[model samples]
Structure formats: structure tokens, C-alpha cells
Target: MEIIPSNGEIFLGKEQSFICKSSVEATMKWLSGDDDEEIEDELGRYKKELIDETTLTLQVTASKVEPDRIIKCQAETESGETTNTEIKIRIIQKPTFVKDVSVTKVFNADSDAKLPCAVEGIPTPQVTWFRNDMPVPLLPGHLSATRDGTLTISKIQLSDAGMYYCQAYIRERNEIEHKNVTVTVNAAPMVTFEEPFPKITSKSNASFTCSVTGHPKPEIVWKKGEEVVSDDGQKYILSSNGLQLSITDLAKDDEGNYTCYASNSLGQQSTTLTLEVIDAPRGVGAGVVAGIILLIILGTLLAVDLTCYRTRRRGFLMFLSTSILGRPAPRVKLEDDLKKGTSDKSHVVNISGIDA
Candidate 1:
């Protein structure tokens, strides 16, 4: 005959077997826990249980064990009294991690910044960073990382300034967690000239300097109208002094206007200046008094010319007639000629007959 038990062993979770003859009473025993010695109630729970691995043959149970009455097991079996066999069992549980972790210090942009973070969880969770929901590049020289999990950014830029988040990953149980930090770089660079707009020019070379400054540093551009002026080997040159635009000769064309632009990852900022090329009066040797005197003389001459023209225009017709005719040789001779000549020709007009 063949006999089989679910596990070939007796245990509370696994099915066991019974083997006995003609329904007689019997008993069995089984080892429980890792203990080599009989398990005591103070140290363990659930007494050793024994079950027939073959056919249901033994009936066995005990209210107490030899070492400690407190250690207990319940078993029921039916068969004739026979020898008992003890069974063996084992006990253990899995590992775990902690929570509520965070970064120790905050960071800045364009400037070097770094910070370490704390992490805890089962299986040592994985970590990473994100800016505006996009994975930020943690490249060396620009960015780097530490073994304990720290993110560092070098030569930080305005664009680098924003809300940043850290992500932790745990594959087992498939868990993901996140933490966030916000950063601000600095304001836009300011552009200023050593001399204000409409700059005065001396015989010496003229210089227009843009004063540029900002965090993460900004790129500067100098422009004359739509055209870009070239300096250095390239059309553009950069410095903390802002974009320097130097022209050896100060021509009248250079006198119009110039512009300076400041740009960075954060955004863009700008300002403009209108340049006036005023020639420093030829020589101071003549003195300021001479210039003032010259201006006065020119003004007086202009006033005289205007007055003469106005007078002539006002009486023009009368003056012209008097010059051409010579005004009738003094009245007396005219009266004598009129009296002698008119008597013979009858100087009376027809209207004299109609009225006195």
C-alpha cells in the first residue's frame, strides 16, 4: 500500500496524514521554532504538533510539554497506542526602511551651489532631480553629484534658477517619492555709460562704455542703429565693463546714437543713448568773451537787415512815383499855365450847366 501526505510533514498550515489500526488511541510530536531544545512558552508560541505523514494511524494530543506546562499544543488522532515521531518547523520575517527625509542646504544659480539630502526606505530608494518637470542635466563642470546623493551646479545661470524637485525610487513594491526647492538667481544686468547721452567729444579719441553687471553674468551687445560695430577679432567682445565699443576717430556719423543690450538665461534687459558730437570750440586761446562778442554782433546785424527791408516794403509805391515824376515844378508856374490855356479852350465841365 502507498501513503502520501501533502508536505510529507505535519504543520498547522500544511495538510498532514493519519495511519492507525482498527481505530485505536495514539500520540505524536513535532519540533517547532529554531530551538534545538524543547520550546518554552515564555520564549515561543504554538506547541510542537505531530501528525502521521502516512495513513491516519495514530490518535495523539497533549495539554502540556515536559520542559514547561505553559508551552502547549493540541492534537487529536485515532489508532492503537504506538510509538510517536516528532516533527520540525521554522520561523522568520523580511527587512524595512524609514521616511521623512530632505536636503540640508539650498542652492543658487550661475554661481556654484551644492546640497546633500537624506534618504530612507526599504531597499535603499533611488534619487534624482527635476526642474520645471524636466530632468535637469547634472553634468560635471556645469553640474556634478556626490556618493551620498548630493547635486551640485557650477557657474549657475538665471535659467538654472527655478523650482527644482528631487525624486526617490524603490523598485520592490514599485514606490516613487518627491521633494522640491525653489531658487532665484539675480536681477538683469544694468547698462550705463561713463558719460551721459549726447556725449561731448574732445580731439582725443572718444570712448563709450556700457556698465554691465548681474549674477551668473550677462552677455552684452553694442549696436549703432541696425549695424553692429566690430571690436577685437569678432564683431562682439565681452567684459565686466559691459560691451566695450571703441572708435578711434570721432566722426559726425558716430554722433547719432548707440545702444547696449544685456542678455542672460533669465531673460533680456536693455538701454539706449543719443550721442551728440559737439566739437570742443576750436581754441580756448580766443577766450569765452570773444565768442560771446561774436554772437552779439551777428545778432545785431540780423536785426538791422530786417528793419530796413520792412520799411522799404511798406512805402514802396509812393517812393517809386515821386522819383520818376519829380513832383510838378512847385505849383505857381502850374497855376499860370492852367489859367492862360484853359480860357481859350473853355475850361468849364458840362456838369456846371446842370448845377451851380
Candidate 2:
């Protein structure tokens, strides 16, 4: 075949073989017409190289051929040529790399984000972070990259929340593998009073509670009417159970709204609990009550006796008309009685002998 060039490109003919560097010296002898044997005749007239031949088989990537990588032969033909002639190979840049990565789940908004990075040509690709399109600052505290190519956001607040991206770079290929992540910080919990406020006297024990809810457990702080009630230094007690706030031992001045502040790492929430204080009533002793009962009984008896006396003075009595010992009668002398009965009257002259 003659030399031919089309569109600034030279094409290798079927008859001419570009042997590899390993068999360069031996193949040069044949190209320079030093051999006139079976090898020469087999390559020219027979054209047996293209009959049952496959492309080259490389262990590494097609475009990543390096100095020490081995090129495998499919037929294992030990022709002693030390290289292949029919095999054709070329070197080119790697294809476009990792396009994107994502984190589907996160425990909390302020927590870190998980991102996966994948490249087209190779592993161990260099990773970089960006916001919108500009490169982000990689520092100790503000931003950090993980071993698995994930990004951990520390103290991610609402301001630091938004779309973020990661890029995988392979310098030789001019390839870029990119990923996008969305960050949302979970809001803090809120606390509130759900029922009637506690009412009590200085002499009585009083208790009240408030409920709180949010992503992270919120801390509660209570306050009296105008003064703040804290655990720092006071007689007022405040206790919380993540969801509840209880205050005990109410005082006289503990009236009005008792404010409660629920705070978390994300934000703060507040609520007011109206309180009413009452003064305890004074009680009477047992002895005083017993004397008052006695007086009441005596007054009832006097009224009953006066009513009975008035009824008896109405002259409601029965008079008997028979000759009884209670009748009024005149008395006769013993001499008049003796004159009526004369026979015995003369014999009774003596006082001892007189009979009536």
C-alpha cells in the first residue's frame, strides 16, 4: 500500500502492522526486509493476522495506560515475537466524572450531613465543596470533610442552612464529579401551661406544671409575678421533666402570671401561667364551740317554762262537792251533845267518868 493522509490524519493499512515497543528491535528487521522466511510470507500473502484476532486486553483503563501496566493476550500464542502486531491501541483522557451525591436522611437539622461521591474513571478522586458555584472555605471548625467523602456541618444554624455541593476532580482528565446537599436545622421546642393556674395561701402547699415539646429537649425556667425564679439563689423551687415544669410551696406574693421560658440549642419559647393567692381562714377552738351549744340549750328551756306558767293561770281545774275531810263544817261542844242524850250525861260528872 502507498502513503495516504486524509483530513490531517494518517491511516495504518491492513498489510502494515504497528508493533508494540517490546518487539520493536525484532520487528524492525522484518520492516527493513532482513527476513525472507515463514514469518514474512505469513504476514504478507496469507493475511492470517486479521482472520481470528481480537482487540487488545488491558488490565487498566483504556485511557489510563501507564509505563508498568501489563497488556494481556487472549490466545497465549508464544510466537517469541515478545509483542503483538495486529493489536491496535490509543491513549485518551478519562470520561466525565461523578455528577452528583446526596444525603437522604438526617437525625437533626443541626447535625451533620452525609454525602456519597462516585467518579467515572477512578476511586480516590479529590473532593471539594462549593456553595452555589463558588468554592467554600475549608477550615477546622466551620467546615470539615470526612473519610467517606461526606461533609459534617457543625452547629448548623438557620443562617448556615441551604443548598451545598461537592465536586470530585481528576486532574489529568479535566473531569468534574458533583453532588448537592440540603441542610435544615431543626427548631427548638416550645413550652406552655395547658390548664388553670394554681391558687393557694401562704399556709397551704401549691403546685403547678407546664408542658414543652420540640426536636431537642428544651430546658425550662420559671418566674414569679415580677421576680425571676431560678435555681441559682431563692426559696422558690422549679423542676422539669423535659415535658413538664412543676412549682411547689406557693407564697402570698406568688400571684399573677408565672412566666416559663423553654430554651434549646436551636431557639427559645415562652409561656405565661396566671396564679392567684389566697389568705388562709382562722379556725375556732373546740372549747368555744361547746360553750355556745350550752347557751343555746338554756335559752330554749326558759322559753318553754314561761309558756307552761301562762297556760296554768287560765283556771282549768275540777272542784268536788262531796262531804269529804277537806269540807268546811261547824263544831258542837260536848255539853250540848250531853243535853241531847240526858241519861248518860248526869253519871259523867267526873272528868274521868264523862263519856261523849
Candidate 2 structure quality by residue, lDDT tens digits, 1-356: 11111111111121223222231223221221122222322322222122223222112123233222112222223455333222223333342344445653334646654545544433245777787788777668757777556666666654566677777776754667676776555668667676656666765655567776665567776666566676542345455363333444556665688777788887898888787878777799899999998787556545533443454422211111111113233221212124674554321111122223
Per-prediction TM-score, please? 0.34, 0.34
Ten-residue segment with the worst summed lDDT in candidate 2? 1-10
RMSD of each: 19.0, 22.6
Q: Against the unseen true structure, what C-alpha lDDT does each candidate score?
A: 0.51, 0.48
Q: Write the per-residue lDDT of candidate 1 for residues 98-148, one digit (tens) a residue.
A: 333343333444568774546654356677777788877867688787765
Candidate 2 — what's its lDDT?
Answer: 0.48
Q: Give candidate 2's root-mean-square deviation (CA, Å).
A: 22.6
Cα error of candidate 1 at position 81, Å = 13
